[model samples]
Target: MSSVLFHSLRVKAIQPDTAEAVVVSFEVPQELREVFGFTQGQYLTLRKEIEGQDLRRSYSICAGVDDGELRVGVRKVKGGVFSNWINEHLQPGDTVNVMAPQGRFFVPIEAESKRHHVGIAGGSGITPILSIMKTVLAREPASRFTLIYGNRSLRSTMFKEEIEDLKDRYMTRLVLHHVFSDEHTDAPINMGLMDRGKIEAFLGTVVPAAGIDHAYICGPFQMNDEAEAALLAAGVPEEGVHVERFGIAQPAAGAGQVGAVVHEAKPGDAEQARITIIRDGLKREIQFYKDQPSILDCASAAGLEVPFSCTSGVCGTCRAKVMEGDVRMERNFALDRHEVAAGFVLTCQAHPMTERVVLSFDER
Candidate 1:
């Protein structure tokens, strides 16, 4: 896979967005401004050393393309090492390693287009959606946006003030809805979790499905699935709906008995394999074992660095194409069916099923 180098940047400020989340802004030097220039809805991968252990995490860029800022939101996750450290100790003037913006969670925006865009986000998933919303509103004056944001409570919502400001600025062009799981409001439609029923009701009443030009959904796995289903059932085209998943949910007990079954290799299924990896027009060969953690681990063990985040396969950062030879993916929740048919695989979850395998990140 292609290696993405991290640049050490100084933290300019940390603004608290909520009790458990903060918006982190980094100082991008003039020399690196072009390198760090990002599109809306892209994310940055940050690496840091905590107590002698190196940890890397990806956070979505919360600033719009024209916002002239390099910022991301970090929500403190319970028992999360990096998140907790950032919330408690990270401050101005601190130097941290951050990769340039990377992600495909957005669509093209045109100033002359008058389209209706809808964004459905949950909790911290609002980071990327906020970027998209701001960019769309700023770049496309003729376009309108409706946001359906859900959180545990109003106190826990990130970017509350910023979103409210956006609504105020784009009074006639923007529509905002807040759904809280733990809070009660005068209107029942604004209360409770944004499940399938809530989404369906919202589509049926406020935003008609047929009139929506594009829809973006980002949240937990179950919420993503439910929202997508409701949108498609409400007449939204499959290509018009975009979904970005942050993580995978643990399967319920006995749920794997049906659906697609991924086969695990036996001890002697394949003793060894010759792996050839192509990156930036360079090729490296390494010997791999079938029982190894993953093709990504084997390549890393051999001193080959590749772009990767959320190694559990939720993020598509480590995607590569299998040029030649067969491979089996242990688990896949990122790549679409077309990408799989095109020989693309998430190296982090892929294992060699043949003796000789050739893969290239350049193809991706």
Candidate 2:
């Protein structure tokens, strides 16, 4: 089981969450249930082959830890191959390749705790926040949760009824706020995008930063940054603000010098970088053009499959540890400072900084 990075999961059902989003539930066999058992706020990497192209994406788990189901939310986007296929073609009984759960978007839940945790989410970003909200509310009875959800409109908001149900169940312990960018509400605060201004206003009023023990934010890169910044600026400790942001950003230039040894090639041709890939208890050497896309691409060209999804590097599915030599990731959003310091790099964004580098997916 440890050797398998992905398992074929049968779709148990598909429920439409909104016009463009759907909640997908997977049927995990009893034997594999333990393997699929996931912590709240984690995500699953789903893969499907369409039009002869292998498409892979990561979707956050929407179900709580005690939900007794493995589920994720998918929202269709323009030119999204996987999302469109999932929304239109996927049916019950269809099998999808799902990687083991991966994420660190949640904080510890203690039963005796009486803390207030606030969540700021946007559009489909509500998925993991919903999971965390439910888990925390149920696991820590004395704790309170405030969810500030942002969407274009009520019709486009995912998990509307489900969140309402949660509100009813946790009545006094849950605070729900819906902020819409399109629809106008009776209250002024509920209108407009959940940008930095709106979030700063929120931290000053409804869910005061001083009362907040922890803050969880998930949304577009800008919104996430704004919300996190607002929380931090309002006196919330840096560690108390947990954010799950998706997008690409340039990494700061490293101070250390990376060694490079040029291999003989044609004039104006690309240099070749040799990489030793260690996976499934086997070590194999493969060479790739330094000018090529990424190390993951080079590995795939060699017919080697480890684990990967969202080639853009937002998902941590392609994470691998550097065993020897060095590799540089152009940009990274999934790995933290500690993980990067420990030599973990997202293979999709990894470029060989040394002539010969060693990568280990086995260590994960």
Candidate 3:
């Protein structure tokens, strides 16, 4: 995991992107430049206190690496405390606790490589995709990018002007397609949600799936699933497609079930289990009950500070390597199969299935 320590950074500017969204820029001090340096498509975990309650949220970086800016887009969701507060009350000069950027949602850009990349995003999901698109266009001169962005309407589209500017600047190398669900467009293809059929049509008409070097999908679960399926059906290799989900999906029945049948602990089952947590080269041993919410919750209850955000298991901030025990995850929307096979588990969703468990955050 990348550095998870929070740094006090002052908000340099706040520009409204939509009626319910704003783009915030932070002032990173020169001393912490190296610590805050982030790759494209990474995100920052912010911590704030409201009415004596602590809240943490992860926001994706929207600025390109070569742009020399550190900014994030915040869209107010219905009943979203952190997002609503940010859109309504956050102002320039206000300080925020921001963790260093962390994520694995990007492919390496090579200047001499002539690759065709596609980005499929929905609403605010464009944040990280914007970063990747801009970086690829700037860093790799021979690369071409096609963006298929979906939103409810133009009014709710964040970074609308910035995207238009990018299209104008990279007219020949960039292809832009805006799909609006609630707005009318002259082109038939620009209307309606991006579902499986629409994605398949796109692969067949607009961009050839065989010519695409990399495909990125970021949005709700259904959209991501549909787009990935279309890509795979079009003969794109599974390894060439990447996805990022904004929230965790409810686990299906019998999901994550291994060979053994694991059930909730009963009165006769072992109540307590020993847990070893390693972070920053330090080890902490703690005992937790089987009924404890999760390993993350238990670690926090023991007064051990472990980095985490979006405890719903959407963000991979709390991922750790399980060294010596078997564990079951309640839900997992962030980790890929390769990582899971390598013994990595999201501590926020993990529960001990063994008597003793040893986990490491420093193992990457």
TM-score of each: 0.93, 0.89, 0.93
Residue-level lDDT of model 2, residues 226-245, one tens digit each, is: 88888999999987888886
For each of the candidates, give the backbone clash count: 0, 0, 0
lDDT per residue for candidate 1 within 1-364, as digits (tens), equals: 4456889999999999899999999999999999999999889998999989888888999999998999999899867788999999999999999988887788898889999999999999999999999999999999999999999999999999999999999999999999999998998889988899999989999889989999999987889999999999999988789888877775778776322334456643457899999988889999998667788889989989887877878778888999999887888877877789999999988888889999998884
Q: Rate the local accuracy (lDDT) of all candidates.
A: 0.89, 0.86, 0.89
Q: What is the C-alpha RMSD of each candidate to the true structure, in Å?
A: 3.2, 5.7, 4.2
**Candidate 3 runs further than 4 Å off:** 1-4, 249-271
Candidate 2 C-alpha error for residue 341, in Å:
2.0
lDDT score for candidate 1 against the true structure: 0.89
Clashing pairs in 2: none
* Model 3 / residue 55 / CA error / Å: 0.2
Whole-model lDDT for model 2 versus the true structure?
Answer: 0.86
